[model samples]
Target: MTTHVYFDGGTKNGTTRIDPPFDGDLYFQAGLFDKEERYLRTDEIQVVDGVTYTVFRFTA
Candidate 1:
């Protein structure tokens, strides 16, 4: 499955933080940038239920 990730344009050092981190290579859409960001490699984050998630990092 392909998951879409949106960045806040707030980068620490070099790597930018993304919401709902996806496993492997996936689509990365920039929220506050003017450039094109089709995809990127990211860590996995999944939702388990309505109030629960596999990796509760971002508050999606």
Candidate 2:
């Protein structure tokens, strides 16, 4: 089965969006830009619907 994860930045949203089917790990740092650009590691992203969204994993 596939799992879904969501990261909510709330008011502090980033300009970049990474979408699904990604492999590897993601590293993000908050408050690095004047706007809100999340500094993500190369593995933290995937492409979906022509757009990019961040991927998160659930721990059981």
Candidate 3:
């Protein structure tokens, strides 16, 4: 199964503090999900105080 994580950009430090706590290397399977769900990678994410956040693109 594939897991999707939502990030809150308004968090304190923004997207710069989510990897250290989860260890390094955020790996995923290519065919885990039938459709691609928007999510942020460890390197592309950050947390502030206790909030996490990320940036994403959406279709209109």
Q: List per-prediction Cα lDDT, in the order shown.
A: 0.35, 0.40, 0.32
Task: In model 3, state the lDDT of residue 37.
Answer: 29
- Poorly placed runs, candidate 1 (over 4 Å): 1-13, 42-60
lDDT of 1 by residue, 1-60 (tens): 333333322231123333454555444344555443454333544433332222212212
Candidate 2 lDDT by residue in tens digits, 11-36: 33333433454454543434655443
Evaluation by TM-score, superior candidate among 1 and 3: 1
TM-scores of the models, in the order given:
0.26, 0.28, 0.20
lDDT of 3 by residue, 1-60 (tens): 112233333231122322323422333222344343233344343344656444322211
Q: Model 1 reaches what TM-score against the true structure?
A: 0.26
Q: What ranges in model 2 sit over 4 Å off?
A: 1-43
RMSD of 3: 9.4
RMSD of 2: 8.8
**Top model number, lDDT:** 2
* Candidate structures ordered by lDDT, highest first: 2, 1, 3
Candidate 3 lDDT (Cα, whole model)? 0.32
Model 3 backbone overlap count:
6
